[model samples]
Target: MIKMALMALRKLAEVILAAFTFGIVVAIISSAPAEPTDPAIWSFEDTFLFVFVYSPIFFLFIGIPASIFIEGIMKKINLRNCVYTHLVHFILYVSAGSLLGTMVALFFIAEGFEVYIVVWSTIAALCFYVALIGLNKIIQFSKEHDEE
Candidate 1:
């Protein structure tokens, strides 16, 4: 029920991650591109920057606060809750990102618009990072309150 720049950011980050995961999970699992230097590959300009750059960066944005919330949901002094939250966060992220990505992909498919993996990844990474930090900070502050 939260309506703030933070929630909007979380929603956006989740959507982007879901979409990218939808696009790249298939690529990463099936093709197994080893290196950008590998000439035999199908160009990972999109994959690397998107998956590696954006996804991990999202950890800082969505992941940290997500970790805190998961901890709250778990409601225990155990570290397991933290781990569980991270796993759930990642899964949620993929789910949302994939849905958005699929819709976009369909657009690309119909219009024959080339998906610039490089461009998409680059933008997602840049935008999502700011959102991630905001979320984690909220979690951290809340955690302190919980401790007191």
Candidate 2:
């Protein structure tokens, strides 16, 4: 129980860190003009503040559940620690992210769908994956050091 709690805490930390980084990237992207003549959609500070504030909620709702579901599937399949598992996980996350973005864009944003919504969500998923993997590596290293 304690170990599980620790893992959950670690995962939450990873998600928040990933959200922060993802927000930074989104802010940069959203603040730039898509074309030479077009004005940027937002000021950098405004975009950053909005994303940085809201993105953790988005990830907490969507990302944590998806990750837990995926982990359950991996465990059931007896492939949680397999060498090729990360690739499968990556594909699953990217596909899910794309589908989610499409749905959100179609239903919420406006009358027309924006491609950048999909792009940003996909990037956010990738950010979460990278953070998870990095955190896992760090934890493993720390465990090994403690054992030695």
Candidate 3:
């Protein structure tokens, strides 16, 4: 029971970290100058503050449940090969990122923010996937080193 709880906690930590990283990347990307009239109007401080405040709630309500569902599916499939495991995880991360992006875009739209939904969503998803990939690599490296 304790082990299971620890595993769940670890997963939550991973998702939260990934979500915050995604938020940061989105804020930076969105703050870029788009046109002569709209020259990077978003304030970094404000964006970070907003994201920091809301991303955990969003992740807890949406991202974590979705990831747990995907993990359950993977376990049900009895996938043991490392390659298959990595592939499944990649798909999970990308899908989660896309879902998160869509939700964020919808929120921004509802709030009367003047932003391109598709662009921001895609950027957020890509940034999230990349961050997860980096995290995965680091974890793998550490595991390998520890086994030596």
* Global lDDT of each candidate: 0.51, 0.82, 0.65
Model with the higher lDDT, candidate 1 or 3: 3
Question: Whose lDDT is greatest here?
Answer: 2
**lDDT score, residue 76, model 1?**
56
Cα RMSD to native, each candidate? 10.2, 3.6, 5.1
Where model 2 places Cα greater than 4 Å from the true spot, the runs are: 28-49, 80-83
Model 2 C-alpha lDDT versus the unseen true structure? 0.82
Question: RMSD to the native, candidate 2?
Answer: 3.6
Instruction: Give every collision pair in model 1.
Output: 17-97, 18-96, 18-97, 18-98, 19-97, 19-98, 46-117, 46-118, 61-132, 61-133
Give the candidates in order of TM-score, highest first: 2, 3, 1
**Model 2 clash tally, residue pairs:** 0
lDDT of 3 by residue, 24-54 (tens): 8767855644333654466666676677677
Candidate 3 overall Cα lDDT vs. reference? 0.65
Worst 10 residues of 2 by lDDT: 32-41
Which pairs of residues collide in candidate 2? none
Off by over 4 Å in 3: 32-40, 78-88, 92-136
Residue-wise lDDT of candidate 2 within 1-148, one digit each (tens)? 9999997898789888888788788888767554435454567777788888888887889888877887787677776466679888798788878888888899998769999889888888888887788888988999999999
Give the winner by lDDT: 2 or 3: 2
lDDT of 1 by residue, 66-109 (tens): 44464455455343576666565455444444444555566656
